[model samples]
Target chain A: MTAEALTTILIAMLGGAIRVSTPFIFVALGETLTEKSGRINLGLEGNLVLGAMVAYAISFHTGSPWLGVLAAGFSGVFLGLMHGSICSLKKVNDIAVGIAMMSFGIGVAFFFGKPYIQPSAPRLESLPLGGWASNPALQQALEINPLFIVGILIAIVMWWALANTRVGLVVRMTGDSEPAARAMGINPIKVRILATAAGGFLAGIGGAFLSLSYPGSWNEGLSSGQGLMAVALVIFARWNPLRCILAALLFGAAGALGPALQSVGISQGYYFFNAAPYILTLFIMVAATGSNSARAAPGELSIAK
Target chain B: MAQAETSFATPPAYDTARIRASIEAVAIPLGALVASAIIFSVFLTLLGKSPLQFFELVWRGGFGSSFSLQNTLQRATPLILTGLAFAIPARIGLVMIGAEGALVIGGFAAAALAIPLVSAEAPVYLTMLLMVLIAMAAGGAWNAIAGWLKHSRGVNETISTLLLTYIAIAIMNFFVEGALRDPASQNKPSTMPIGKDYMVGNIPGTDVHWGLVFGLVLAVALQVLMSRTTFGFAARVTGGNPRAALAQGLPVGTLIVVCSAIAGACAGLAGYFEVAAIHGQANASLVAGYGFTGILVAFLARHNPLMIVPVAIMFGAIEASGGLIQRRMDMPDATALVLQGIIFVVLLASDSLYGRFAIFQPKISTERT
Candidate 1:
């Protein structure tokens, strides 16, 4: 409540927001792209867990964090390919397949990740953005990872590409109408598969950010459903790449609220604060659903169905 | 292509078509099971473990003896209940995965309620009955939130149910680790135990608790409710086409909400039994993934209440063998999880096979081939 306490809470929350939101940024962007291609991959949660574990184990064994990140992305691609291929089959439900992929991805991750839980892995470094600040706490809070910048840049690029590029047109066409796309000589299935795989690649990188940067460890509990939350974020963002960054930052702040409050010597309702993002997402969803039909969604997207 | 044209050229008899439909229902899921088993065996072999030995151990550890069968049955109890939870909503075209959350909240509610009553020396029968009712009510209400949202606002039920699960767990954690934490439960924060005097006893001749009986009775009752009643008819119509159901003047929203509540209640009862029969207290242990596993059970059963019992028991047997598999094969307990994941994926993918099978294609013409 005091000026100093408020400063402390603000600084801690800012730091936590930067730390926690990086994963959200990548996953939301990934989901945004996938949804734009008329598919929703709920297995991104599994992708996150497996990516975190794979990133950590690869980093631990190779002593190269970047390599681990790359491996994590590839692991996500593999899972994404599995999801895309299975879902492409006739009569299969996309949502149910997503659920299966989630379980499969998580199960495989846990099975291989058991041994890497205790060992420390090489981690990604951050640039001190607050180097000119006099306060050490402020300086620490300003340290930003390279991925944060990369996420922002990618968002801008995606926003531009989605609106301008020939590839973007094909993707949009396919998402809007499968028959139309087929008439235009674009195979909707292929486009969706590739888009899903690309989305998965981003989600994997997001997982790497968790283990290699902030939490910076390989563990089963490393992700708290950040992957799943990305769907909500994409919806909140109206499937815009640029808006995903804002949504991710907001979620990061919400996630950081509990820890930030605890840092300021206020520990009451910590669990409630911990659950803020889910509640917020649910509220936003309810609010969003009330205003729109499938108007904001891709015509061929199966989420509502 | 020519063979298919020839088969289709002549209309088939009604009896043959009926036989084909029946066979396909059994054959598809059965084939999926066999396919997943083969894939799992390949996975084990790649890991340098003998697939043959692993399965033999599973059989011996799960159902080889009376004790093992009872253990499997005990574990199956929760799956059966949770499967119904998923199955009921699925019948109404809703993907409700909040059963896990419902179970946790339901169980936690039961434990939290027991504190003052036990201290007040409430009669054992009254206390137990109250706990069961409280658990079911808690769970039912919890899941109903998602159902209501889907109908009222068009919120995606799958995502909503998933979010509710996390919220449910957080709510339970808030209580168990805070106001209701028993000082005696160090290292693992937990609620005050209901005590052995209030614990539900097992069947007279078996080690399995009364939850099994509850699951059996509920499964049969729900099967009838879903297949043989007007409510069931309305639900099936809604599931097939919500727009059609609405056009028919069916209460679509009510059916959706009712199915979700029943699903939640079933899951909640599983939670109550976990408290009253197994753990004796509510803690992090109550957060076990029984609710998630029940999804696989329901899927394997094709969301049929009657079929859920058998599928759940098989899954339970697989899980009951986890410890044995871990020890004998030097594999992690997640081996079972991996197998389940594979089965689930394969089963869902096998949906494409349903209409593809020539035998399963019903001939409405009813003419002799």
Candidate 2:
């Protein structure tokens, strides 16, 4: 590849990483919180999709993108609450409930989202960070959405809270040892339910980013398993909120590789390139879960067991 | 020896207990189905649509007539295989959710294989047999990757399988859109058709293809194998308690791999049938949500091979009537999907109800007094 081509691909990938990773960042951070509480919400993909639809529809009707984002978050919290409550029942498996919740979310989204597919919605604004750069391409590439910045802030705050805050400590205690948590007068179920709902709220905001900023539309196929991928991203990040930001960006860059290469006139094996994130996730799961590195896992997590 | 044999013989109460347990097993799922139906009726009523009419349309469009029954059976063929794909690995305690990937890759592989055989003027039967074997092998290898990863590397099988599914779709898309694209397939971008002469024929006296027969036979054969054989016994033992199986010197890893491979093969065979009987070529059409639907069917059937038949047909009927419901009720095509989602959630939630009811419980010998 020529130097110009290489520069284009790199710049495009950088921009794509920012654009694509915003959703991943939020979803991963959300998943991180849930996993830290000893639960996994595989249904976040469903939440993401439903959130996208709800955000788009609410934005269209209310004429405010911010309200749409909040609506999406609330929708996600609703689904998450249902999932958490169902899973809290005796003999109920969290993983199975997640799958069922996913179907429920998707089904509801598709049913309600049919009418919103054609309507236009107000989009989230972006901040041009490369205004001083002479190159138009660089400036365009640097036009990052505000949600991406919000996601980063949330990750930082979450990281600090998870370490220093009492509530975070309690969640960590519940996750690390249920008996210890119980001895300390903590109700594991309530903690898990709240954490899952909060996680869902974050994931819903991620969905809003997808529909209101990047893709800027509502459709049935808006999310192609990004919600599901975030689960693996959390594991790759080792359950750390700050690490989740980096991991999401890495996955986003991987996702962007196909479009980036295509932009540079490298269309060969485009589909293969499109699959890079999934391949990366699978490899990461294998490497992270291997016997040597298993100690990084949360003690009470089912995936760890 | 005779005295010991007599003492070990089946007690009279054993039959009653077995019968009672079976009855309860059937009752729980049946109750779940009824509850879902009622819940769905409420949803329909809220929408200003008649629940009774909607159900009437479902029955009329799915199985009320000969034509509808045939359509239901045709759709059920793939469900049965995909249901088996899930049910088999589930027996080994693995949540292998990539059956869709296996199906797509298997169908693509079969279609690719057919091109060479058709060009060489190979006999139709021989070509199809080769296609089936290749598809099964491709799918088996696809899923075996997850099993191997789970056992050897401690990777979670569920995530791995789901990832492999996306990879499988990419692989299929790469080939279909590039190397294997038939020039005449234009907008759809499909592989070359298997040709009229090489297509699998319909079963005698019915419009349904031989795939239905294949599904039925496989379901029965798998049921027998799982319940009446040593391999099945070992698999159950491993599933129930892996540590115990390992302590007993059973090769648990091998069982996991073999079961996954079998599951993949079942899904692959469904793909072959789709190519040979339904679509007559491989394309994006092969990625229909049949593999995912099979998950619901398998779960509803509680992963019983024998029960998969009824569950598959039930789902198949629902799917077959989707278009009719759309036309008659003015609902979107996703109405059926919504119902399916409702059923899945309610059924899983009802799992908690098991053993809670006394009627379903067997009479304890001590409690009988």
Candidate 3:
């Protein structure tokens, strides 16, 4: 590739990484919180899709993108609550319920989202970050959404609180050892339910980013499997909130590779490149979990079991 | 609490306990199904649609006549194979959800292979056999990646398999839309058709293809293998307690890999049938959600091979009526998906009911009472 071509690809990938990583950041952070509380919500993909649909519909009706984002979060909370509550029942499998909730979320979204497919909703505004850049392409690429900043702040706060805060200590205690949590007068079920709902709220905001900023629309195929991919992202991030930001950015860059290359006239194997994030995630899972012992996994999580 | 203590104090007879266990197995799932139906009815009523009319349309479109019955059977053919795909891995305690990927890739491979074979004027039967074998091998290898990773690398098979599915679809799209695209198949890109003469024919007296026979035979064969054979016994032992199996020197890794391969092969065969018997070519059409629906079927059947047959058909009927419901009720095609989602949630939730009933409790410790 020529030097100019390389520059274009790099700039495009950087911008794409920012644009795409916003949703991943929210989802990965949310999954990090849930996993830290000893539950895995594999159904987040469902939440992502439903959140996208709900956000779009609410934005259209209320004429406010921010309201749409909040609606999306609440929708996600509802599904997460369902998954968490069902799983809290004795003999119920968390993983299976996650799958079922995923299906439920997607189905309901599709059923209600049919009418919103054609309407345009107000989009989230972006900050002009590259105003000083001479190239129009660079400036366009640097236009960043405010939600991206919010996601970063959340991750930082989560990292700090997980280490220092009392509520964080309780969640960590519940995750690391159920008996220990009980001995400390903590109700593991309530902690898990609340943590999962909070996680869902974050993931819902991620969905809003997809519909209100980037793709800026609602559709059945809006989220291919980003929600599901975030589950793997949490594992790759070692369930650390701060690490989740880096991991999400990495995934975003990987996702952008195909479009970046295509923009630079490298169209060969475009679809193959489109699959880069999934391939990257599979490799990460294999590498991270390759050891016989669950080194990075939460002690009480079913994924470790 | 007093009632439970009293029940524990007086044990039921062995025969009665055995009958009750069987009854609970049937009754619980039945109860879940009824609950789901009632819940779905409420959804319909809220939408100003009639639940009774929806059922009537489903019956008419899926099984009211011979034609619809045959269509249901044809749809069920793929579900049977895919159901077995999930069922097999589930038995080994791995959540392998890549059957859709296996099916698509396997079908694409079969379609790609047919081009060269047909050009060479290969015998029809020989060509068909090659297609089936190639598809099975492709699917088997695809799913084996998950099993191998799970056993050797400690990767979670659920996520690995799910990721592999998307990758598989991308791979298929790369080929079908680029290198393998047939020039004539514009707008909707597809591989070259397998040709009329080489296509698998319908059964003599019915419109259903031989894939149905393949599904039925394989289901029975798998049932026998899982219940009667020494390999099956070893697999059960390994699945029941991996540490004990390892202590007994059973090859746990091999069992996991083999079971996954078998599951993949089953899904691949479904793909082959789709190409050779149904679609006659590989295209975006091959990515139908049969693989995911099969997960529901397998779960509904509790992963029992024998039960998969009936369960597959039941789901097949529901799927076959999707269009009719859409037309009659003026609802989107996704209405069926909503019902399916409800059923899946209810069924999974009902799992908590297991062992909660005293009637189903084993009589082993009851001698003290």
Candidate 2 Cα deviation (angstroms), residue A25: 1.4
B1-369: candidate 1 lDDT, tens digit per residue: 445545765343455677787788889999999999999999989989899998898899889999999999999999999999999999989888889999998998898889999989999999999999999999999999999999998999988998898898888878877888899999998999889998999999999999999999999999999999999999999999999999999999999999999999999999999999999999989888899999989999988899999998998899899999988888987788789899999999999998795556765333323
TM-score for the A-chain in each candidate structure:
0.97, 0.98, 0.97
User: Which digits, one per residue and each the tens of the lDDT, describe model 1 over residues A196-239?
Assistant: 99999999999999899988888878888899888888888888
Best-fitting candidate, scored by DockQ: 2
Greater-DockQ candidate between 1 and 2: 2
Q: Where's the lowest-lDDT run of ten residues in candidate 1 chain B?
A: B360-369
* Candidate numbers, best TM-score first, in rank order: 2, 1, 3
Q: What are the clash counts of all predictions, listed in order? A: 0, 0, 0
- Docking verdict class for candidate 1: medium
For candidate 2, the per-residue lDDT at B59 reads: 93
lDDT of 3 at B85: 97
Over 4 Å off in model 3, which ranges? A290-293, B1-19, B364-369
Q: For each candidate, what is the lDDT?
A: 0.90, 0.88, 0.89
Model 2, A113-155: lDDT tens digits are: 9999998988888999999999788899899999999999999
The best candidate by lDDT is 1
So what's the TM-score on candidate 1? Answer: 0.96
Off by over 4 Å in 2: A291-293, B1-10, B363-369
